[model samples]
Target: MRRKLAAGNWKMNGLVDDLSEIKALTEAHPDPDVDMLICAPATLIAQMAWARGTHALQIGGQTCHAERSGAHTGDISAPMLRDAGASHVLVGHSERRTDHGETDADVAGQAAAAHAAGLVAVICIGETLDQRESGHALTVITDQLRGSLPPGATAANTVIAYEPVWAIGTGKVPTTEQIGEVHGTLRATLRDLMKQAEGVRLLYGGSVKGSNAGEIFAVADVDGALVGGASLKAADFSPIVSALENA
Candidate 1:
């Protein structure tokens, strides 16, 4: 069975002082049944890692460069993230795709780099509201998945997060049936494309929170969530973790 994960993306947020939230999170779920992670900003990664201390709460980076090093002024490479105590890094987040024009091939290269550096890559793929309304959501999502995943990707080093672009940070969510449809298609696609597909975890994102987490967790093939705004606080996130644990 795939292990449930409650992963948070702090995005461009978090600071040294924000590490106290991690303390509270680890305290709340000292022996959590599910895996917990927080991907903070580049500036606070090392400090967040230090703050987590001996707790099982994992630390990660929001995004990483495809190349290992050199010339990219503001880009953090996967190896650099690993050096700073990050065991995982997000690739192909929607914000990066829109704000930086990150193509699927570019995301694939980034995921490959993360794997080479021995960090798990939380590869994200999703469609827009327009695509869903036009009856092309499945095709768009499948095509993105096919193009964004690297040849070296495996269940152990890769996790897939499906976050619809229109729903992220907008207090909107796809119905549970909508989530199930996408995740089911993703699982089927992975089975045809990889050797260890069944073991790979599929996480639903976009407007995920404590209030709706239990219902979301009950969806088939929804192994966990890639939470956004609600993940910023322990009180908000802990119940989601608990819901996953109970699920």
Candidate 2:
């Protein structure tokens, strides 16, 4: 069975003081039934990992460089994240794709690097508002799913997150039916591409919060969520985790 994952993308947010949130989370949900993870900014991965020591809380990087080591300036590598105690890394987040102009191939390379470093790659794919309006959402996401994923990606080292561009941080979310369609399609695509598809977890992201988390988790094939803004606090995030646990 696929394990449910409630992952938080702190995204460029959080300071040394913010680490307290992790303490509150672990204390509240110690031994949570669902897997818990917080993907903080590069600066905080090591500290967050340290704070989560011997706890069920997992720490991860928001992104990583495709090359193991190079003169890529500010880029952080997968091995570096692993060395800092990160067990996973998010690849191809929408902001990265939009801000850095990362193509699907670039994301694939990053995921491959994460795999080589023995870290799970939470690969992200999504459609823009324009595409959704044009009835091209499925086509766009399917293309991304095909291109962003690397060869040899298995359930153990790979996860897929679908976050609609328009919904992220916009307080807008795709209806449960829409989420189901996309997740189901993603599942089928994974099944066709890899033998370990059944074990792979599919997470829905985009304006996910405790208020809507239960309904979202109930959708078919939605193993969990890749939460943003709401993840920054324990009060807001813990209830979402509880929803997933009951789901």
Candidate 3:
């Protein structure tokens, strides 16, 4: 069976003081079949490790450098992330793609780095508002799938997250049919692209909340979630996990 993962991207959010929230979330969330993870900012990775081990929740990094090490002054290499105790890392998030002008190749390189360091690469892909409005959402998304993943990407080494640009943080969500169409396309793309991979996890990440998580997860190909704001609070995120468990 495909393992369902619920990962939180604390994206530029969280401080040393915010560790308490992670503590609270871990304390409130009991063992569920779904995988629970937190991708905090780089500065807090080491500290998050302690919180994760204590709470028994998974720890991850928001991003990592393409290179394993060396003169990349501001870069945090994957090996370094691993040393910091991060078992997973997010790549190709829309914010990184847009704001940082990261190309699909950049994401692929990052994925390769993550794999080399024995970390799961939560590779992200999505279409812009214009692409969706222009009815090219599937095409855009599939194209991203093709380019964002590295050649040796096995299901074990990677995770796919579809976070539509318009929906993320906009309090909007794709229709069930729309979500199915995209996720189904992503699954087929993975099957073709990574012919030997086993059980690649496909997660939805656009405005996912407790109220709508069940319905969103009902889509045929969705295996998990890459939650944002909702993940910061246990009250909101706990039910979403319950929804997945009950499903």
Q: Candidate 1, which ten residues in sequence have the lowest lDDT sum?
A: 11-20
Model 2 off-target regions past 4 Å? none
Global lDDT scores for all candidate models: 0.94, 0.95, 0.88
Best by lDDT: 2
C-alpha lDDT (0 to 100) for residue 101 of candidate 3: 93
Residue-level lDDT tens digits of model 1 in 22-77: 99999999999999989899899888899988999988999899999999998899
Q: How high is the lDDT of residue 173 in model 3?
A: 94
- Which is the winner by lDDT between candidate 2 and candidate 3? 2
> Model 3 — TM-score against the truth?
0.96
- State every prediction's TM-score relative to the real structure: 0.99, 0.99, 0.96
Report the C-alpha displacement of residue 194, candidate 2, in angstroms. 0.8
What lDDT does model 2 reach? 0.95
